[model samples]
Target chain A: MSAHAHGTQHFDETKRANIKFSAEALTTIENLMKRYPEGKSKSALLPVLHVAQAESEGWLSAEVMDYVAELMGIQSIEVFEVASFYSMYNLRPIGKCQLEVCRTSSCWARGAEDVVDYISKKLNIKEGETTTDGMFTLKTVECLGSCGSAPMLQCGAEYHENLTEAKIDALIDRYRSEGTRKNYTDLNYTNSK
Target chain B: MSRKLLLTHDNVPNLHTIDVYRSKGGYASVEKALKKMTPEEIVEEVKKSGLRGRGGAGFPTGMKWSFLAKPEGVPRYLVCNADESEPGTFKDRYLMERNPHLLIEGMITSSFALGANTSYIYIRGEYFYVSRILETAIAEAYAKGWLGKNILGTGYNLDLYVQVGAGAYICGEETALLESLEGKRGNPRIKPPFPAIAGLYGCPTVVNNVETIAAVVPIVNDGGDEYAKIGIGRSTGTKLISASGNINKPGVYEIEMGVPVEEFIFSDQYCGGIANGKRMKACVPGGSSVPILPDYLVCKTATGEDRLMTYESLSDGGFATGSMLGSGGFIVYDEHQCVVRNTWNFSRFYHHESCGQCSPCREGTGWMERVLHRLEKGMGNMNDIDLLVELAKKIEGNTICPLGDAAAWPVAAAIKHFRHEFEYHVLYPEKVKDSKHGHKEPIMPVKPAPVMA
Candidate 1:
């Protein structure tokens, strides 16, 4: 894993300079900071990461993580470690629509496997592997605390549950067709919604 | 209908003040512990009570406290592992949010027992509201002279702080939590010098679960021997089981240890049986990390004893037959649920949360997830079953932390208990169509590209 980091060119300082947290992100960080007493802005690391990841197109970059570290007045490595350590904060670029499939035990017994298999085959990529077209990335995640609806997957933020091959196929077809229509119309379709 | 122990009076009239808690005999334990008992006596009481770590591992809490290296003149630390990241587990969140003072009282008592002057509560990142609740409660405790220097004029000074983790499941591991607390990466450090000996800035530290710490208050208040008498041998005391999924009552239910699984699941006193009259299929008795127990094995074990929710009884048949009560995440599955798809979903979670710290975990989790993904998508072959097992084995014990084991146990258990599901996907590919979102194409072909070197 360290080797992958070695060959990749280090992020340029100019790229780092242009990375600015949006107003919403800054406000969320400030609110989280108030949760702690004075002189403990570092306590906001996780909330800051959450806001940053949300603002930076659903994933985090090394430069953005470093910038968060600077904003929180902690070591850059501290922020990097957190971003890389968690499965939620994506370090690299992800597909336009990220599929978070809950593969925990309850979901597993509820036919989440079929949903995953259906999604992967439909998208033409295995888990953790994004499609060449960059439309979707197939990834499996742990329980998203929604065990009541087993066999569930979270696309962007909305959860689609009781998933079967047919249900998954239709959902994907709708998203794909919607993407194509938006492309032709030049309408900005926010995938998260 | 009885008064709630933790969150009983969240809706009670005028119940949020320190005076209300005191009126209900809340700080009586703190006053008694401070005025009467010595720190050693408190630790001995806990030891006598048979209180175990409520944080899934079931380590003896008193034994853990004893493990602290006591080299004279060296400072020791106490850290409450509030980083409750276990899947299907949310009891700690409720405890912090509704009954924050219970945890604060417990922390103070536990800290006094450990002879620590400073402590921290490492809460999960997503529990933003709970963190604020704890902070306010801490301020309240400080105002009452229970947390700050010379608490209640006991001369034992202590300071407590709340630290938030960056939402990594691995940080729930004690050592990784310590590392995160120190403003470092949340990776588990190799153990030898366990956290008890050298933790949290290289001092003797005791990292305990929130429930474990909170239990201390009750134990110390009621006297350890009295508390020990409540439950069966070794597993004495009550445990908070977060029952969810296909249950008539889905919430944190506190029951005395050694309650039979049949009672816990089917009894009106507990989970109130499977929801909507669905037949029980399987159960992840513990959190998502433990193996799944099929309906046949969910009953009494070969010991001719009904499976109880206690740590020992739950582990009776090991992973081969019985599941653990780990973190007490009781997730029940109805027969309508597909085992293959459920396992696939769990595999995806492990793969995503692998942290890429070790080769086997990083690569193996990804591999198992992909194979399971294919099987779910109806693109699996018979060989893929063997490959998934092999990949899980590779990741099982080959990582820096137990996160690898956490990821592999579910996969291995799923395949063990539900092999036919994998076979079903392979045999009837047409039945498992594409995801509802897109064209029906194979996600992973019958064969996948070899993991990148």
Candidate 2:
């Protein structure tokens, strides 16, 4: 659905420094680095990328990756390799809303295809296609551990499970009305225990 | 009512909070463990309880804990494998989502028992919401002096942190999880010093599943022998089953290990039978990795014994007519579901998730996916079925991790259980090309078990 840097980008020092993360985000990154033993700040790379992606645009550009590598005291290639390895880190810019529907065995058998088709048609887009307005990006991911509540789609930090056409319609309408980029680090999607 | 050790307080409102959890006898185990019991005594109790690892491996937890090499002045680690990305498996997610404190309390008690001062719950990045819930609970634990230096004044200090993974299923593997934890790719490590000797940060570590860690709370509270007395032989204690697919009531169920498979699937108390009055065609008793069982063999073993949900009973007949109790991910397939398409879906998942460290898994999974895709699309020759079997055999134990075997088992078992379905697809392609492609009746061979290639 989204494009990734194919491991050919060079880390420019000036570009890395120009890529600014929010002051709060930098503080959070520094705090995360403290979780590991001294000289082991590399352990904070994944979490820092999460906060970085949220603080910057929805995706991690090469400059952003370089920035992360510089901050974590590791090579830029290290950040690139780790970031590309995970599906959650969007390397390229994505739509405001990324609807990752689970398409593995349990979700598939329980009608995930129908959910995808419904969302695609509702948004006038196909699988892996962002809408013309760049309001939504549709993706078919493996599983998000909601097998029991299958036919589920994950947007940002929220899981919308047991989908129907009406629910998809309502969800899309709500997102369009809200016109906000849903992010994983957004505290509003908190599902209280 | 079935006994639920971990989720006994699941329906209790605000059970996720430390106050409610502790009010309901939550941190008592931490108190008992830190103040009264020694680390060796806890390990001995777990060994006596017959608690097996619930993260699909089913290794004895006590034996695993005892295997930790406690050398002089070495910092051993306890990492809770919360990377619950297995298909049809969400028990760990459900456990953490509803009852965060139970797992936190378990982590504290377990870290004390494991003699580790620092522990981490390496949750998948997808569950950021759940991680936030856990972090809040951990903060509460810290505020109340349950964590940090000198916990409970018993001189056993444990700092529990929740580290989120980026999105990789291979990270669920212990070594791969360790590598990811160290800010590297999620490729699995080659075994034989294993994790007990050399794991996280290249130190001796004990990596356990979320359920395995949470079970430690009850083991400490009620004694492992008492916990052992609840379920059948070997499969002691209750297991959390993440039931989904073509079922009337698809949700998480904590069942005693000795419950009959029929009752659990058909009875109103559990899955409540096939959805929309459809007949059950097949079932994956454990997670997607374990072999699938045809309807005929789902309720009873080949020996006509009532199939129970215990580890020993569910896998009574080996892979021929049985499946392992893998992560307790129970997926039921109705008569309307197509086996060939399901096999292809699973193959594609493996192909996507394989970390490419092992060539056999990385290449073999893609090959199987392509073949299964061709077969599912009704474009396969008769030889393609056997070719699929051949590919599965080649990939089955050839990888650095079980992801290859996990990818192989469903393909082999799909053909093993439903060869006729594949043939039907080949012989009559037009019948399945339309939108109304449902396997009306299944032809399951019960006489002779097909020998694995």
Candidate 3:
């Protein structure tokens, strides 16, 4: 019932039939569910919702939330409450590259506001607005645990840190040229290890 | 240049891999805990170490573990509170990202001590990269006999799982974290049924910070008494301080407890003094949640006693002239930084992060943000300052969780320490509106216009 007038929450019934996890993703979800006890597969809802968001573009459609609820054996309201509570989950549509810059104390002290302003000027879009080409959506987020490397932003799974105006320019150019929808699943799990 | 207990080999190569970690005596504590010592003895050793929780509250770790309720046929759970979303705190992420196997080994030892067969690392969602690092370490742990099933022919079976929370700052609260781990909205549960008694599917649960669990490694390796000998007074063992903001070296440093606050800030080996050769104006020696202290108060107490980083020393004057060593998130602010704007930024963060479960926190945080915004933007009268004080007092002890307190402290501290800055914004409205006052330097120097084609 909590609605933001950015995007339609309802999706076509036909789209719901097609929306699902890939074989490998399903295996990952099953393994995740196994981490809990019997009849506690619902505990995997948050992580699984991330997977569903990755699969169905960058944001969570109502159909995707319902599907996640079904997959985890929880109610639709449960999924909606969770999806809305978290800042990471975008209920509406977003650009190909969602630039979530940290605007908290540590990052702010180190010039996060300047970085936000720089990105806005470069993209000609205000914070939380997608570019006309649907290439970038600039958003200011809270601390992302990369405070040491302050004035940072996250695009897909990449954390661009120690940001300068020139670095922001270069990053914008790179993401713009990539020209593909960068899903949350675009993360490189191997690189982090 | 200080003693490094937990981060002993922070600079070692291939430390992330289990093979490299094991080569350097990684699972020795697990061996010591499981094969050598009994569960009670392990608990006794932690109590002897005098180790306190590193995740902000500074609770006694050994006493916390001893409080776990054990009903027959009911399993106990150990959850590592990796949801390190505190604004200026990133020490846990650094530990888990660079030296992850240490945390896993620590988890195994802790799980054994608590008789817990299942454990979880509930990390913040934004640290997706660090989560994978932890997962890889966990898989490597399982591949060996360190985790899962009986270990070294001992009748102890343990399963460790990593649960990633979708971004909620309130989830850092233990009860809220349990709700999040149960895949629910992270609203802090009212106490009386604490997590130790009834938590996580109504089972006995022990939630500790990643640093707290990882510190158990050293406490088990070296006898608790030996570990206790390193630091002064009750603040035993070395601690990880995540230094950021206007400090020259903004990273995680593992320092022996009882280090002098001034030395930690100005010394060459530590933060290396204020950034850009600027004078120190103010600081939140802990994370953003703690009271902000000006230069003189931060270095020494009102009684002129040298302030040390210990819990007792840092809070010598009790909020009137003291702050906390909370979570060891040392944030420095140069004289150029504006207190009004910084307070406004913190207000916005709290407002955005409020879970909206309690009306005081939900509505009060928003009201504080709006008032601070007007004050910062030079549109407020002087009475707004008194209004902020009143609202902060009302919200402090009235909420279900510490978040209301967290939100209230910065505002209260800013007003307590830097009322002149707010007055400056109000008095010189036009001047303060265009050019931010208090800070002598610009945030980011405007780069020259790009060469026109």
Candidate 4:
């Protein structure tokens, strides 16, 4: 058996035990964990955070980061450093749907400016600010890795590509409806149509 | 006609298995290098081949390996930079996904040459599935005694580890990756102490791209001199390009380095020309970070020679006319696509991904994203164009790492090639329509809810 050194005892184990990862989320974490060599479970920190962010509705609270730290056997500071470093891992709470608009070169050339404006105006929030109704939060991210489509956004895990003012509005409307109905299908499915 | 090398065994089914790989003469290089050749001889062979780093920079691979600090008793490390995060680049991902054993074989041979006992495959977080595949392959190698402790009974003890990053694009840089591997923030540390001298827990380290390391297997097996004869002068060997967007065949294709761009694009052997028979508007010859080249400039260089896919030919005029083969991400766009909107999206990516370690990149990226946002929305002014260019310039060489440059290059290049489009949007805001059809206008003056009292 491989001897594992669970980094530092940073978070309360009792509190961590109370906070459980969903079966799906745990499975995803386990899948990411398999990517590293034995005893290197710390390598899964980022992917686990991604799943946690999704499960917690687009933001990672302190408790959750700590919980993740405990689960990964890494320092809470290590998790904090990661969360604060990348723009994708949200450190604070966001609106129901986190609107991450790609403002990189390819997307800009394709008309991402209009998409940002439309989203900001529609949500009544500037970039990095959550909406008043808590329905949406607007943020400008780097590349979401879909440069071919260009002018894309990541609303939660789903990427909204080939965006326009009308598409941005429809996306907002769909999110609003999904929020109200609690019958949330994939946003990408709607965008594809 | 045939792939000849580089990707000859790519189409062979079950190539990922050790049995299939060895059947096709895999590990032949390891045997040759360990049994007959000296480490110095292997290095010389690679140097003679004129092989350069396939991961964008085009730095000579042998030169990189030679730079490894051989201080008296310290253990040097070998790291394969599998963090293929550049947009428009999916070649490495496919290479690993399809042929994981190739990478493993390369890693083992390279480790022996470098005198390094330990190696790590630093992969990007999004490559979850590919990483799993690699881990499985590593286990297979260890089982066969090709890895870990006296590999092939050569008395060369080696250990391999795979470290997955937290999805930061900057970590793709060697120094930043070293930091991430050490359980630190993924910010790029200052150089002078390059990873060659101090890296991976402050030890001498050699970091290489997935393809660069994988290419070593063939070089060592065939004798570097034979590999050197494959391509044109100083731009020797083949290159694997990930051709995507508005193309008939959007996948990874490996060809000789000196193949012409026109042939690569229009030839049935390569991309099979643009999709729907659409006219080509522009080409991002490299990855997203490269400058865009209009169709007219895509043909031959000023010397009237065909713009071959070699490093020298593609970057003939630098950013002024051509772009580098950075990571071989060849993205083609049709005339219908608007350049301004495309630039805006790229700006947003940089802004969001900036590690916030420096003032220029952190603030400048955000400002560029905002200005591009207004421009794409048709609320942009004439001065915003210059402002965008100025901001990009500020962030260009001012950041802690090349991430800033990666973020700025596309903006500077977009404005250089398509300033007129930006001006058009400013002059005629009413005529500028969103590319997505049938979408409605967003409500004006969106404001976030005030903090609770």
Cα lDDT listed for each candidate? 0.74, 0.87, 0.87, 0.75
What's the ranking of the predictions by lDDT, best on top?
Answer: 2, 3, 4, 1
Candidate with the larger lDDT of 1 and 3: 3
lDDT of 3 by residue, B1-453 (tens): 688888888889999999899888899999988989999999999999999999999999999999999899998899999999998899999999889999998999999999899889999888887888888888888778787778887988998888888899999999999999998899999996988999888899999999999999999998899989988899999999999989899999999999999999999889999989887888898898999997878888877899998999988899877999999988888877888889989999999999999999999999999999998889999999999999999999999999999999999988888887787778878767754455543332122234567
Identify the leading candidate in terms of DockQ.
Answer: 2
Weakest lDDT window of 10 consecutive positions for candidate 4 chain A: A184-193
lDDT of each residue in B1-453, candidate 2, tens digit only:
898898898889999888898789889988898889988899899998899999999999999999999999989899999999889899999899899988988888878878899888999999998999898888888888988989888777777777889899999999999999998999899999899999989889999999998898888899988999999888999899999999999999999889999999999999999999988889998888999998989999988999999999989889888888999999999888888888899999999999998888999999999998988888898999999999999999888889999999999998988898899889988876753388454444444655578
Choose 2 or 4, whichever is better by lDDT.
2
Which stretch of 10 consecutive residues in model 1 chain A shows the poorest summed lDDT?
Answer: A184-193
Tens digit of per-residue lDDT, candidate 1, span B1-453: 322345545565434456676666777677878889998999999999999999999989998898888889987888999888788787887677667777888888888888888788898754545666677777777877887778888798888877666557777899888877766667679888898888977889999999898888888888889888877788988888888777777677788887889988998887899878877777888898899877766767744678888888888878776678799988887766666666766676677666676888888888887888888888889999988888878888788888899888988888887777678778888877643211232121121224566
Q: Put down candidate 3 lDDT per residue, A1-193, tens digits, no spaces.
A: 1212365645678878888777776766666777799888788888877777887768898888878878777889999999999988998988889999999988988988889888899888899888877788899899888888998999876889999988998988888788877655433232211
Query: Chain A TM-score, candidate 1?
Result: 0.80
Docking outcome class, model 3:
medium
Give DockQ per model, in order: 0.18, 0.58, 0.54, 0.16
Worst 10 residues of 2 chain B by lDDT: B439-448
Q: Could you give candidate 4's per-residue lDDT for residues B340-387 as a string of tens digits?
A: 767776777677667788999999999998999898889999999999
Candidate 1 off by > 4 Å: A1-78, A87-141, A144-193, B1-17, B434-453
Q: Chain A TM-score of each model, in the order shown?
A: 0.80, 0.88, 0.88, 0.76
What candidate 2 gets wrong by more than 4 Å, as runs, is A1-17, A187-193, B439-453
Better by DockQ, candidate 4 or 1: 1
DockQ of 1: 0.18
